[model samples]
Target: MEGLEQWKIQAEQWSQQALQYIHQIPPNQLYAALAVLLFPIIFIFFVRLFKRTKSNTIILSGLSGSGKTVLFYQLRDGSSHQGTVTSMEPNEGTFVLHSEETKNGKKKPIHLVDVPGHSRLRPKLEEFLPQAAGVIFVVDALEFLPNCRAASEYLYDLLTNASVVKKKIPVLLLCNKTDKVTAHTKEFIRKQLEKEIDKLRASRSAISAADISSDFTLGVPGEAFSFTQCPNKVTVAEASGLTGEIFQVEQFIREHVKP
Candidate 1:
């Protein structure tokens, strides 16, 4: 008890000395000292906060029968899980890539959301776009011509979305069902979509400024509509969700989500 009392007394003396020393310093110097000491603490706090809040979500979207659901399941299960019916609601999950489950240590989990391709349910995409690390627009490679216009329209909307455009989110035009002999090549699909989008651009531009519903316009005016003209990074790749050939999709995810 006596030793405790002495320790308390010594602490009080030290506190008093600290106060005296602080009082002896000039006001400006003391303020500068406080700032110097606090800056690193504040900086570290924000850095940690950002890292904690950074999203690992990847959004999968496309027209119905585009194989998004198949891809989603394949990523999570490493298998197509047999026949996959059309998804009516968003199929959401957080998991490590099934392919990565077998190899190596400490694989990061991905937050993947497969938004329904039906037009009615596509609105749900806006909810996740703000937090998405990247977007994969799955296209039906086998039926590319029949759906090219609709796919281009959907892709245009995504490219112009406020969140997607503002964040400069990277987009992957994934041509699904590439394993099929009739599947269109990525180069062909890309050129066709660009042509379709170019036509849409001309039509949409005729509308008055007040009537433009899209948050941003696509491509540069008076120039041919090309993926390169987009403010964000747009890329095209081929994949077969059913055949479990999705290395490109996995690469895109890791590029944005860091594992």
Candidate 2:
């Protein structure tokens, strides 16, 4: 009982000292000091209360004949925009997906950009990476073998880009043109790409770090390269952009870009 009473007296004395010190300061100075101390607390509270908004941009990219433009039109207009030629420039638009147009509620529009596959036009992809919610690399499934190396190299570069790796942006390896009976399966295309990438990874890692242009590296050091090994979410899906059978593509967009 005596110890408890002594502790209470000490607490009261500290409180009195604090009150005395606060009173001694002039009103203006006191207010300034209080404001300085409270500013950061108030700022932090507001920051937590209002979280950053997610980006609604999605990038569609791939080789020239991979049907990226077709997919873009299909998503926007539900038609193949007949007589579409190779896009020398990016085809971009912000709109609600055609598939969702019939839905009961309103849908959030996505800003979709299809960066052309031409070698000279490839650098434009960097301009959009910062705001991209996800990236879709369309592969020509019907012509997978002949273009596997080129596709793998492009994909390796994309997977190693500084923005992509640092942001951990999701990537969809879309094997397009699955409507044809002869079109390769997504699994086969995935495995071949992995094998090709594994070889590329080995050769690239042999170069001196100073000479390496890619901002990041891919796969585990000692194991074969696999999509699962990517730090970012890498997934494979089949689609036929020419036939408007792009349910998987729509699903990927909806997964990253909220309604």
Candidate 3:
């Protein structure tokens, strides 16, 4: 009888231990399950938030003799210089551009990047171009006739080969040094660009027709070719040889890229 009583007490203790173990399992499993499931959800939420918050970048590119540096400084601090190149590295100085744009009646700030124009620094430019929401191509207006062909060729290649910038990137062409005598007017520059575009079309036609050995000598019809003016926010002005035109360039950028 005594032995039976002792056995009963031992059985009660074992049952209590079993109950405690079972209770512990559920809470531990609940936490473990939450950890496994909630991790991915939290990660995705943060990733989306970061992507939404990312700032847009704008890249400036042009020839060595072009006023890329002068314009960059002017755009940044209203400082102007003639016949000089910017020797700074990427991300240097107060390169951040802030502006206000009405989006659903709310204003936002946008970031812009001023890229180097040297051919040797092209790789660096390529890296930044993909991130740019737009591009500004500066041309020396006074040297347009003499340098138009080369400038256009370089511009075409840069615009065509860059997979990221080719299709959707908006490009603005600024005819610099317009304040000088003999500097082509905006209309004249547009006309010259139109002619170059026609030449490019003709070249493409010839290349395409050559594939089947067809008549590749067909000329591009002048009527079929049209000049679509890059959306102009400001008039071209003389940037060098006297008088400051930096403010004009800054105003144009401000008009387009509202941050």
Candidate 4:
């Protein structure tokens, strides 16, 4: 009878010990599980918030002597002369503008990028273009029909080839050195560009039609903006008549760059 009683007592003790051991859990393990569940949620919330608040980037690209540098300086300082072209190669820069709109009764800040205007550095320009929300193509008004024509053609081809640009990037054209050409009105410049753009569109359409018939690959259509004739001329050198064209370019950007 004593042995039976002792065995019962031992069994009860073992049962109690087993229950305590099973109930005991480490605090560190609980904390680790909580962290694993909550960390991704917190991280995702911040990432979405950042995406909502981020500003868009704009790229300004063209050929040498296209007033890109002048525009950059003018946009940054509010005034600059259309000096001799300093950008023989590709370059990158930024400008900031304060914008106010009645969107949920709040104002916002907008950021812009100014790029060099060199034909040889087109590959570099393409690299930055994908991030651009808009593009500003600056042309020297005095050379619009002659030397500027080449630049215009280059711009069209570049935009058409870029996959990102194929989706209708807002483009603004700034006609610099307008003060030098007495006979050239804003309308004249617009008409000239419109004609050129139409020709390019017609050619591209024909090529696409042919490609379809021949079962060959066709490229993106060339796109150009409805010409906005801006007379951006300021005298950079008193004797050279290289006026400050950058301010005019900036004004155009401020008016046209979409949020």
Candidate 5:
């Protein structure tokens, strides 16, 4: 009992000393120190709460003949094999990017799907969209102008899909096959698609169906359409599967899918 009393007395003395030291500091300085200590804790809590699981599936979609298959083969094998055949079925695979493979060993693989541009097979995309880490919408830059409206329509439908909007799925408007000198620039294609979508938005709104399944909408109300208005991130990049100039496409994939 005596030894316990002695230890308690020592603890009280040390506690008093610590309190004296804390009280000696200015109130403002104490508050500043407490805030500095708390900031990281608060920041970490929010990050954990908001951070989503890293999805491994990356979707590659676009109109037929936009070279989605070529890009897929290029990503998987680092080659176009000098030709391609359109598959009406979804070309799905999980493999490490051939571009990232090194002398040491294979890098992390991704679930990539080349959904046929044909309307009949495009529905297969829904099966994977919920798990998609990112989506690459390939555009045939060489024939952009001729297919601009169709491309825009397809893109609009995609952006408005509930899966994409609710999950804030990032979409890369990848302009492919840029090796051809006559191919359009990414900037030109983005603008044309935006303008086309704006017109479609107005026309679609006029014929209101009470049963119209509402998904996400495009652009600001009463304002011109642009990618910035999207709730999800939308970006445009250029690539050429023919010449293997696909750095930006690979970058986009790694940015969202990792490794």
Candidate 6:
């Protein structure tokens, strides 16, 4: 009818006007306009991929009496401060390492945090993990056999955390207290931890979903568990916080936190 024909003519006129406007623009301008529109999207993607925020923070974690606080004191001042009292809140500091102080303030300052090992306080670990450059998991080498299962359970939780796993945050399984003559070797401790975590993996799997705690499963299914199986870089090192033999821990910190 007459009304339908008139509406079609107006639509055709609008389409022709748009085509003419586009045709009037230069090809170079069109390309530049398109690029300007896409610039924010490309920049956002690159930011997520490259992680522009490189952190100087390092985290020390372990069960009570694994010498985490002692190591923190040693790294900051090269002394134990006559032993540490139990810290309900995290002990945090930003300072240049004591060993590198001889360089006359040349080295970069580290943002070190010692998360309390108490189960009630362990949840505080995640607050600093987002900005952590590395994680050092202290183990009591002198009491390895007695604490192996508990240590593995704690470490297993760390390994399965979404941030730790997805960010591929490097972990140092530090066997501390090697100053003791009866201290277990790092190799022995590593193997025992792997065995204990393997057992934990199986046991955790059998639990109901509602009772599960870890966010991710450790190691491949039907496979024996090992540090090598972790998505992140996992290394073992020996240290003696009491005797001031923590060279490896310092080296790991320096490697991760650049000057």
How much lDDT does candidate 3 score?
Answer: 0.59
Give one digit per residue, the lDDT tens place, for model 2 in 1-259. Answer: 9999999999999999999999999999999998999999999999987878789999999999899999999999999976899999889999999999999998999999999999899999999999999999999999989999999999999999999999999999999999999999999999999999999999999999999989988999999999999989999999998789999999999999999
Error of 3 at 195 (Å): 0.9
- Per-model TM against the reference: 0.86, 0.84, 0.59, 0.55, 0.78, 0.84
lDDT of 6 at 216: 88
Instruction: Tell me the whole-model lDDT of each prediction, alpha carbons only.
Output: 0.93, 0.95, 0.59, 0.54, 0.90, 0.93
lDDT of 5 by residue, 1-259 (tens): 9999999999999999999999999999999999999999999999998895677899999999999998898999988866677788899899988877774764678989998999788789889898888999999999999899999988998998999999999999999988898999999999999999999888877767674454767789899899889989999999999888999988999899776
Q: Specify the poorest-scoring 10-residue window by lDDT in model 5.
A: 207-216
Enumerate residue pairs that collide in model 3. Answer: 99-259, 108-259, 109-259, 110-259, 179-238
Model 6 spans with C-alpha error above 4 angstroms: 1-21, 25-51
lDDT of 1 by residue, 48-101 (tens): 988796689999999999999989989999878667788888999999998899
Quantify how close model 3 is to the true structure by its C-alpha RMSD in Å: 11.2
Clash pairs for candidate 6: none
Q: Report model 6's TM-score to 2 decimal places.
A: 0.84
lDDT score for residue 251 of model 6? 92
What number of clashing residue pairs does each candidate have, in the order they appear?
0, 0, 5, 9, 0, 0
Which one wins on lDDT?
Answer: 2
lDDT of 6 by residue, 74-125 (tens): 9999998655787788999999998999885478999999999998999999
| Residue pairs in clash, model 4 | 62-117, 63-117, 81-244, 82-244, 234-243, 234-244, 235-243, 236-242, 236-243
Model 2, stretches more than 4 Å misplaced?
1-19, 23-50
